[model samples]
Target: MKKKLVMMLLAACVMVAGCGKTAVSDNFQNSDAKEQEEFQIEVESKIEQEKCFLCGDAEDSLMGYYSKKESIGIVHLNSLYVSETRVRDFDDDGNELFQQGGSSTMVNSFGEGYGSVAIHGNPDRGYTNIDVSVSDKDEVDFELLEDRLCQICLDTLADFYEDQINSGDNENNGCSGYCLIDFQTKELHRLSEPYSGYTMGDYYVKYDIWKEGGGSDWHRISVFIAYLPERVASGN
Candidate 1:
């Protein structure tokens, strides 16, 4: 089951690429101590520029546990919802035509943050694809920040997914559809969209389904977990 999940995720990563959208790349795999330090400095500097972007919605509601000082950004993994499952088609010769099945759930956040998840198909063929993304309504070049932050964000997400799968919490889980992450409230808005409203303090990190395919790209998984330095000392 564990191996199955990994394959599904890796497949999704490839689909994300074919859609003309690029996943953020990192140098953690081959970086030496000096190179690692340089990467850290670059990450930290970007975090400093817009600390609030990485933070949850703290100004809107005061009832939940929100923190802008403890993290530079939060990562959220959306769940996948499969409408068809356990259905297979094949020719008389047993050549499989198509099969439908999926079980990918949303992983809890590592910190206070918010966003959605997306998936294209069932897990039977291991065609689940998920992309964790972000957007700044302020029209700022936040994609650059996303590129630098994805390394840590994916690390956080992989830990959550691995933990869930190992614990058997992933049984019958399908890809999470569009949803919202209220890290401030520690809540997930499933099968929903962001309400109409724009504020400078509002931020978003979206993880959606790019497409479906089998791609053996383990580099995007936990490979960077060991390279992740501590969270930013303080938010900007």
Candidate 2:
């Protein structure tokens, strides 16, 4: 009887050990499967949210142009005439930034034709060149006006950049470096290092509208240009 009891106790211990091992194995397998499922979901979500324009493979492209000339006013009255225009395009996902279109002009403020007022575009940022023109009168002050215009261009470009990044069009893509344009000097500068800061996640995505004028007197211009990531990557 004693021997049989001992044998029964041993068998019970064996069974418990076997059960524990099986439970552990099952738990590990389940955990692995769950992890794989989550990873796949993440990839699929990115793919779905990716913008076609970022890849430059789109059916439609955005284009813009601006021109100003002495339409009906005297040259002196048109002191603030802007005859040049340019457009900057960023990734629909907002990772890439660059300028494309540009314009130029000539102005005469006091019956004396200044050399030429040419607003050149930065090859990278699309910001206009230095307001270059010979001074017809030594006292004609243009610094203030030039400063104001440069500020406008900078503000417009910055707003456009933020809008594209916030649009829920792509994932795993963003402005890697600090991208900036100086309109006053017509310089394009990009950081050698990548951008490191807080970013808006999937749940809090929002759309932004950038405008130049206000109220009923405002004109809506879509300066947002869309291009595929591949094309933009190629620098085309």
Winning model by lDDT: 1
* Decoy 1 TM-score against native: 0.19
User: Where does model 1 exceed 4 Å of error?
Assistant: 1-149, 172-236
Q: Provide the lowest-lDDT 10-residue window in model 1.
A: 218-227
In order, the Cα lDDT scores of the candidates are 0.27, 0.25
Total backbone collisions, model 1: 16
RMSD, one per candidate, in order: 23.2, 24.3
**144-197 in candidate 2: lDDT tens per residue?**
222222333333333333333334322211221112222222222221112221
C-alpha TM-scores of all predictions: 0.19, 0.19
Q: Show pairs that collide, candidate 2.
A: 53-227, 54-228, 54-229, 55-228, 55-229, 56-228, 56-229, 120-129
For residues 1-236, could you state the per-residue lDDT of candidate 1 as single tens digits?
01232212223334344454554444431232131111111122233222223232223332123231211112332211111111222333434454444444443322223323232333354223333332211111223334333334323333333343343422212222122333323333332121221211233223322223385211111100011234576877
Candidate 2 C-alpha RMSD relative to the actual structure: 24.3
